[model samples]
Target: MISQNTISQVFETARVEEVIGDFVQLKKAGSNFKGLSPFSDERTPSFMVSPVKQIWKDFSTGKGGNAVTFLMEHEHFTYPEAIKYLAKKYNIEVEETQRTDEEKARADERESLYLVSEFANTYFQNVLHKTDQGKAIGLSYFKERGFTEDTIKKFQLGYALDEWQAFTDEALKKGYNIEFLEKTGLTIVKENKRFDRFKGRVMFPIHSMSGRILGFGGRILGNDKKAAKYLNSPESDIYHKSKVLYGLYFAKQTIAKQDNCYLVEGYTDVIQFYQTGIKNVVSSSGTALTPEQIRLINRLTNNITVLFDGDEAGIRASLRGIDLILEQGMNVKVCMFPDGEDPDSFAKSNTLTDLSDYLTEHAKDFIQFKASLLARESKNDPIKKAETIRDIVNSISKIPDQIKREVYIQECSKIMDISEEVLFSTLAQIHKKDYQDANKKYRQEQKAFEVVKNEEYAKPKVDVQYELERKIIEILMLYGDRTEQFEDLVLKEDEVSGDLIMEPTIQKARVFEKIYLDLQEDEMMFSNEKFRELYYSIIDKLNQEEEFSTRDFINQLDQDAASTITGILMEDEKYGIDDWERYQILPKKKTDTLDQLVSQTVLSLRCFLIENKVEELKNNILKDNVDTKTIMEDVKDYNDLKSLLSKKLGKVIGSYVTK
Candidate 1:
């Protein structure tokens, strides 16, 4: 457990932009930084970071919070992991509080797997450098591939010794659990027998975007007919190969800088290109490209230049992957190396300048590349040529942007020497087919929707009570400790006339106090559980602290509450700004209307509650036999109170009152 002082220090020192910028590529948007959401695949920027408030909100997904919560959401870090990461980032000396046994036992399984992988990463690196067999075999293989000692260390390349139980035995000796090792695919354990899975292989550690080791891809050094050439860690809780891009941790910053990524097919290709100073390169780890992996790169850039090997057959088979990239709305370009050269071989043989020059000269847009490759193969065959044109048309249709699809259709028309009318007709046909197919999927899901649609209790309705409670909470969070003047609506008797009247009295109180007094006088409790809990929490904090900080308060909250608070603040900020101000059409400021805002909001809530009470009292006659006379009088009294409240509420709503 981290000490309170340390947590406070971390929250105070660590900058949100500085922390989140490590993962997201943020650009200045007026006072805030805006970027494409890492949480969703939106072309426009919806992720906003307010450095002033020390919080961020992804409008695309509605996930908002302080920096700590950002880490928890984006990196899947445990609360402690996020804190420790920040403490490390800001160079804070974390002070520990001793944990009880039960607390220690509560640490989750995924984090344990992460620790095990981290340990394996360190252990393998040690073997590659420190041990005789590792140095001779693993180091030798990497060197032969033209990788330097610095390159080897940069990629965290390592070697696994040939002995069957070498890794498993050493891991167990160090008290690392065999269960984790087996799960991470570092060891094979069955029938009480254990052996190293990557034995006699050179290791390439696959990392998450944040530089944590998720798993390893090991290449067998020996050409044994019985053994596979490359072995990847099996799917586990931490590592999913289809979603994990090799070398993304190192490539992301450069990709963001260059505004393009060079895609390859293996670990060595990424490392080799990176070693050659082409740093914005990543591999799919030989897995077919997935939408998840494409979105990962999409965070940094919308452009991808896929580097293909010189094999025509492989290129033809991989054409579908190009459509996947296009479907993501990514600008796709293809660069094919010369015969007999892969990215690894090409980079190894050429100087940085030569390799860079070759890439610039050879890269072609996917439409042109696909058309040229497919068309050249069917140049003399009219039937195959027509089929090639349709194949290229299909690729163009995968592009999500309608405008881009049109432009590409024009390009495809010129390339295939076909009519624009024909191409547009074909596009319409493709879209129609796509819609039908999607509608079929929708029909299949209609049964699921049918089962779901009837549960009115499951569906949240328009809730005025909950909204009012939430508004009170939002107002408190935003202006809790600020002092303000309020017109307290006082009920009094007109003794001379023998009638009742309402009087307004001036009083000074903090914003939170004004809200608290109103609710307490009404004997009201928030109907929403979350808002009710938060209402008390906010009041207690405001009462105790002389100086209030929203960021600090949020940092101390549980994730759900923190997210809710941040969401409210962000949503308010979004609407609070009047965009027409850009046209010199200034709107009223929130602070200028604070008094009226508070009075009207509270009055509105009271009126709503009174109306409900009146309804309930009126409905009592519909119930079992009761005293009709007493119920009628009670209803009349409530109605009189409701009427008085409505008058005051109407005055507040109609115009601001200076009391």
Candidate 2:
């Protein structure tokens, strides 16, 4: 259990924008900031952050929350984990009770696996830096490969001791369960005895997006002819081979800043590039690039430059990954190093500027690269060349961007010497077929889902009435404390000393005060759970500030709250700077656009409530006919509502209009 004092301290000191900015590249959008959605793959930004409100929302996903909620959603963190994450981020001390043995035992399996992986990482680093053999062997090997001491430490490069039980024994003695070790693939267990999985090998820890160690990649250092050159931790709950990209934890911020990613194929390649001053780079670690990995990078930036070895086999194996990237709506370029030159070796020998310039000058779009590679093989053969063009066009059609697809089509036609019309026609046929298949599948899924829902119970209509009322509450929450100067009518109570002093008529004067007091007098509290949470948060902020700006609303609020407030403030309603502008712009005559929207929303909800009350009144009247006074009171209440509506609507919009 976290202490209340610690929670309060975290809430007080933690800034929403600062915490979210570490993961997202937020740019100023009006009073708030907007960026590409981290929850989904998107080419254009749909995620927004508001610092003042201390919330974030992804319009694409419809997920909104405070800072802790954002972390819990984005990183799949437990409540405690999210709090600890924020505490670590803001440099606040987390004061919490120690977990009991039962609590530890009941913890998530994935978290246990992550713990094992972290243990293995720390053990490996200790062996490499502290043990003589590890230093002499593994450290020397990394240094020989041109890895500097800082680079080695930064990447947490380490070597497992040659003895099989060295890591397993230490982990067991430290109270790390041997079962978790085997589950995380950190230890190979046999006959109830565990042995280190990467014995006598150099270790490369694989980390999740939030930088928790998930697994390891090991390279054999000995001259064992039968041994594989490298081995990776078996895919475990915490480490999915397809989704994990090495170095993302270190490179995410740099990638967002650079607005591009340098994609390589190995752990060493990532480290070497980083050592050479190219920071926005990550590795697929020789696994076939997956859409999950591509989306991870897409969350940071839209552009990806795939660096592959110039070997024929290497290029062929990697061609398929480019289409995978394209399917995710990312802009991909290919940079092939010279034969026998991998990114690791290439970066080791060249300066950052030279390598960057070479990559810039030589990188080609996937279509051109594919065409060039295949055209060489299909030279002088019309049928094979046509087949090659179709293949290139197929990849081109996967692009979601129409302009990008068209540009690629033109380039493919020019390269293959085919007419642009022919290539486009081929692309259209392929795209139409794919789209139809996808739509059919989607419709079938929807039908199946509806059948299930209808059989169970039809979903309740989204409480739009409740939501509209909530929006009104949100507006009150945001501006409730603001000093709104209004010309209020007041009557003078006393007359100055004079023989014939006369009482003056009522006078109107501008009075300035907070909205909270007004709402208090009316006896209203924000009635939505999320809105109520935000209301108290705003009150806390208001207490801390002399004057508040909307910028503060976004920047100070949790990322999820900020996102919601941005959507609420910017959506549906039209803005009016001048009173006359409202008349000029609004389509309705009863009131200006903004007021019309507000009134329509409020009245629709109020009518629903009033109708429900009327039904209840009729039920009461039916149950007891002697209660004429009660019936008359209900009738008088309904009349008062109608009169109020008449004043508001300028004329009665309902059937019960009374002049």
Candidate 3:
């Protein structure tokens, strides 16, 4: 619970572009900025940031929101985490309010695990810097690897003592629950005994995209033949290795800044690259690359240069990743080191310029790389060559952009020495089959959705009456800034004259709030719940503003409403611009049209409310003749009311509104 002043400052001072730019490489596109989608693999830019609107939209995924939402989505941050992120980004001091005991009790178990993991990270880092064993072993190992003191601290490399129960003991001493530590895999719990999970290993903390410690990866030192060379934290609430890339927390900025990422297969590979002046590098940590892992990288940059040890298995693994990367709409380029070399050895053996130059000269597109690698074995074997061609075509089809896919297919035809027409035909067949399957599934789902939607209520037609009301509401929301000349009666008492004088002053009242208050007084409920909520929300916004701009209104609205408002404002009308000029767009026809729409919407809502009330009345119907007569009188009066509603609603509700 941050202070109100702090929250305001965070919102005010935190520029959307500035905050988002820290994570995204944004280039100016007109009044906005366009970048590769951070949420999806994209070659061409689909992520648009409107600096003016202070909002971002990812056209690839159809996800858009204000700055807070970008943090929440891209970083997987909770609402509080997003707020805190912004607060930290803007350097606003957070003043948390006291939480009740019940809230503390209800704090989630997953968060507790996160807390424990975080605590463990801090403890390990402290050990590395503070303790003799940590400095001599962990710090010494990192320094020996040519990592600078700053780099060591930046990556938070740490150490765990060889002594059993050292980490567990300290954590428990600090009042951390051992159960959570076990759950988070920070401690190994065997029967009733608990010991430090990464004991005697050089610690490498794994972080979530938002930089929270999710788990650890430790490298065993000395003659620990009984221990695995590298042990990673087991699956926990916060740690998902398949999705988490090592060094991403540090490399995200550099990757985004350079608009490209260097992918490696080990932690040391990442360290070596960073040490050798390539800051935008991350590792798969010796695991087979996952779609989730690729997606994680996809969120930061579109161009990926996969650096692999020049081994057959490494090349095969890298080939496997290329298709996944292509499927994500990312541009994939392969850069293999010399035979028997890895990123670690290669970077260390050469200067940064030499290493970078080698990568630039050697990098090849996936299709070309795969063809060259496979052709030697497949040559003169038509079946093998055909299979190879199909594999290349399959990879080409995985590309999201049709043009890019076609281009790849053409390139494959040239490389494989196959006909372009044949490859294009094959692609068409695959695409057609895929589309049909997808279309059939989508239609089946659509049919099922329709059945469910129709089960509770009959099919709805255009609700003419409600449409009128909605139209009026939209008018109020859109043109609410129209200042009408109104005379204000001011009573002023003058001491010198000893007389009170009545003076008339012209004042402008905002129509939006006026309509809003008027509707509130009448208890107006629109037929559509969403529209009703939106109506009230728009009114609330207007009330908060001194002068309302439709653009401002749209800016504050949710995406759907904003789009709807844009549609309404942008829609071209066939009827009258000359008429609009004379009427100030509020002539009888337009006003009557809007007024009619609004009246109809209100009437429909009123009818629904009245029917509900009637149901309640009927539920209580019973007893004496006097009571019966009163009920009958009320019913008769309601029938007359219905007739009046029908008459009033019938004119404008002719047929456009939808329920």
Please tell me which predicted candidate would have the highest TM-score against the true structure: 1
**Clash pairs, model 1 backbone:** none
Q: What would the per-residue lDDT of candidate 3 be over residues 263-317, giving only the tens digit for each residue?
A: 9988888988898899999998888889888877776677999887778765775
Local error of candidate 3 at residue 323 (angstroms):
1.1
TM-score of decoy 3: 0.73
* Candidate 3 residue pairs that clash: 38-299, 462-657, 463-657, 463-658, 465-653, 468-597, 468-598, 469-597, 469-598
Model 1: lDDT of residue 150: 97
Candidate 2 lDDT score relative to the true structure: 0.75
Give the runs in model 2 whose Cα sits over 4 Å from its true position: 1-13, 90-108, 439-464, 485-608, 624-629, 648-659
Residues 1-659 of candidate 1 have per-residue lDDT tens digits of 88989888988899998888877877775467777788987877778888878888888899999999999999999988888999987899999999999997898889979988988889899999999999999999899999999999999999899999988888899988888888888889889898889889999999998888899998997879899899999999999888899989999889988999999998999999999999999999988889999989988888999999989988987788899999988999999999999999999999999999999999998989999999899998999998898888888888889999999889988888889999899888888999999999999988675554467777769889878888888888888899888776677988898677788888888999888888786798788888888889999999999878888788888999999888887774453223344577555667887877888888889889878887888888788888888888988987887888788887776667553
Every candidate's lDDT: 0.87, 0.75, 0.75
Rank list by TM-score: 1, 2, 3
Error of 2 at 185 (Å): 1.7
RMSD of each: 3.2, 6.9, 9.6
Q: Please give the distance, in angstroms, between residue 216's alpha carbon in candidate 3 and its true position after superposition.
A: 1.1
Predicted candidate 2 versus true structure: per-residue lDDT over 1-659, tens digit per residue: 78777776776777767667767777765456777788886777777766656666677787766677777787788877877877887788989888788987788977777777877888899999999999999999999999999998999999999897988899989999878888888888889776777878999988877778878899999999887789999987778888889999999999988899999988999999999999999999888888888888887788999998878887888889999899888888998898889899999999999988989998988777899999998999999998899889988888888998999888887888889999889988998999899999999888876544363356557776558656654554445444422322223335554343223232222111233343344244545777767656666666766665554465456555665666565442212112234355543432223223333444545555555566777777767446868776986797666445434444223311331
